[model samples]
Target: MLSKIQNTFILIVDDTPKNIQLLGTVLKNVGYKIIVASNGIQALGILEKIKPDLILLDVMMPDLDGYETCKRIKESEKLKNIPVIFLTAKTQPEDIVKGFDLGAVDYIVKPFNSSELLARVKTHLELKFNQELLQTLLNFQRDMVLMTDGEKVIAANYSFLKFANCKNVEDFNLKYDHIMDLLEFEVKVEKNDVSKLLRLPKEEEFKVKMKRDNGEYLIFRIKQNVIPEKEVSILSLVDITQLENQKSSLEEKASIDELTKVYNRTKFQQLFKNILEENQVNPKSLCLVIFDIDHFKKINDTYGHNKGDDVLVNIASFIKSQIRMSDILCRWGGEEFTLLLVGSNIEDGVKICEKIRVQVQNHPFIQDRQVTVSMGITHYLPNDNLETFVARADNALYLAKRTGRNRTERN
Candidate 1:
């Protein structure tokens, strides 16, 4: 692919026939394609049709001179990036400075050696080639990428523009003074602080959340690389929102009962442990209620297991709706369930349980038959542990069964 580098077109814009011929020959001999123009106006006209890799411009010309010609070329958005080299006899320091100020990459005197001309042409063309190659690579990436010189963004890939909903660089510049301004940092960087972003440690990686035009926020993993010699920083952002969502989904699936969509037994144990720890540190009124269907086995045997499954689901849904968000409800295997009411005493527990019990007794289940639940309530004590606390609730549940079928009992 590097062989294509030699095929780059060079536009020679000089009034003198001899100078154009000499420069064309020198460049063409080195495998470069050359186009000739007699004056600055002709060169600008040719530019409208063809974009060249480099322009050999002459300071002395008729109508529009080299300085004005160079200024117009730099002003044009399409032609500005093309390197221009001034080939002229006017070798004064001021003349050279003017060419550089007008955005000429290099200035060559008229009596310049053929070897020197070839070397300068090669250097500038190679630099432009490498820059284009880098941009192409950046555009191919799935991640958004931007290159900045600490104050403003100099280059950005197509992905970055699409992610920002920007049509082009000009549109991006209109909305943001700096690229960091668009980033909602997870931590550090003091909210749109470009200085801190530039000085971010090489080993540290942070996250930024960006809101799209569609009102959705995307999370990105941001990494910065600095080119110390040029003082340019390249920032690349990878979208990680989907991955985070998948992880959260897996964690929730692990804790939820598949049939009823309620907390499973294992999750209940874990939460109950945390509650005990917190109560030990700061005491609070807490109650444990263990309940189950009055005749779950009979329901399954009479109406089939599928209908029994429906009954369990309806009971869990009703219980979940009756409790506060702070309360915990778990399917404690089969038709049995456990509820932990945070900051609730035995009285509050009884009140909530009675409401659920009454709702279950009146609510129609599968086949429109009446359904009821028996609950055993117990409050936490200062000396209680997991086994003792759960045993008391279980024992109360046994008594509720011993005395009657559909009722709430306190232990």
Candidate 2:
């Protein structure tokens, strides 16, 4: 939430230079952006150029009076929404009524107290902010908003009525008193104690997930604002479903290798670590196999990097087809890959690796070239951590390469 005074712009339109200086100094010292205009005509010209959040207009001016200037402003389509406050020397009730009738939201006497000026400015600014915020939410068509006075619903936006399938607030109340009761909220609340939940201390914000009429799921961030003086609570449900979906899509893309479309080393490490922790309690049979293309560098040097990449992609797809859905495959590094065989013992792991090695030997990766792989197989040990376990498999791979290329070794 941004502070009310931050980024607030006020236009001071007065004939007196001393009054303008005093008001500008007071507002600027409190962190407000101020634009000064000497008379009402100049102020209206400035309004045509820059729209300020609030305006302070003097009732007496040379060419155009404050009342006429304010009238012209209220007639304009773009500038009518700006809140205008009149600075007048008159103290009669008719003068105040005339200012209000001419569209001035408030009036301040010429010799005004600084504290009262500050308070009125702050109040009107916040009121404008709230009104604009609600209008914006309605315009975007993504937020469902409603106001309640603890027990009864006072008002609701069109989006809320549409969601509830009602014509108006009265129609909505006939079916549901609390907005929380209209949907299946993910957060659990007491059955008959909704007021306690609505009156959350300090107006806490939370999230809820619900399915829409079109069978799609939507997530909303609920924000509650309580007005202690009015005893009203404004509840806003901001739609964040698209943002959450995009975040998950980004995370999925991050975990996958770009070339082979298989899980990358980082994702593989996370999955294996979780499995190792779970195995300590359940003790399931698990196997880890590390394999790499034999003479991969020579193949890349002789053919091309493009052909090498194609071979890697084809090999990954074939291996994925041969493995079970429960198994995990990841691209460990350049020309190297890992396979985690869940619920498979050492013997079954070695047999699977041998089959893959023989199949690669027979399969022609290119028109006239043969590609092969050597694998090292190892199963989980009760006392092994991730580092020690991977190191053992890597040592076995070194042994297999040392003895002969295209063979599987168990360690």
TM-score of each: 0.78, 0.55
The alpha-carbon deviation from the true structure for residue 333 of candidate 2, after best TM-score superposition, in angstroms, is 0.7
Segments in model 1 whose C-alpha atoms lie over 4 Å from true places: 1-6, 15-31, 59-78, 86-103, 107-119, 140-154, 165-174, 178-189, 192-212, 215-245, 273-283, 366-368, 383-385
RMSD of candidates 1 onward, in order: 4.2, 14.0
lDDT of candidate 2 over 1-411, digit per residue (tens): 244576889999999999999999989989899999998889988998999999999998888989999999998878888999999999899999999998899999989889999999998988888887866675466578888775567778888777667766767778776555554556786645556666766647877775555776788887788876787878788888899899998998989999999999999998888876665423347888999999999889999999999999999988988898888999999999999888788898899999989998898887888898989989888887777777888888888899998999999
Please give the clash total of every predicted structure, in order. Answer: 0, 0
What is the Å distance of residue 139 in model 2 from its true position? 8.6
lDDT of candidate 1 over 297-331, digit per residue (tens): 99999999998999999889988998999899999
Question: What is candidate 2's CA lDDT for residue 154?
Answer: 74
CA shift at 79, candidate 1, in angstroms?
Answer: 3.3
Cα shift from native, residue 233, model 2 (Å): 7.6
Candidate 2 global TM-score: 0.55
In candidate 1, the residue pairs with backbone N, CA or C atoms under 3 Å apart (3 or more residues apart, or in different chains) clash, namely: none
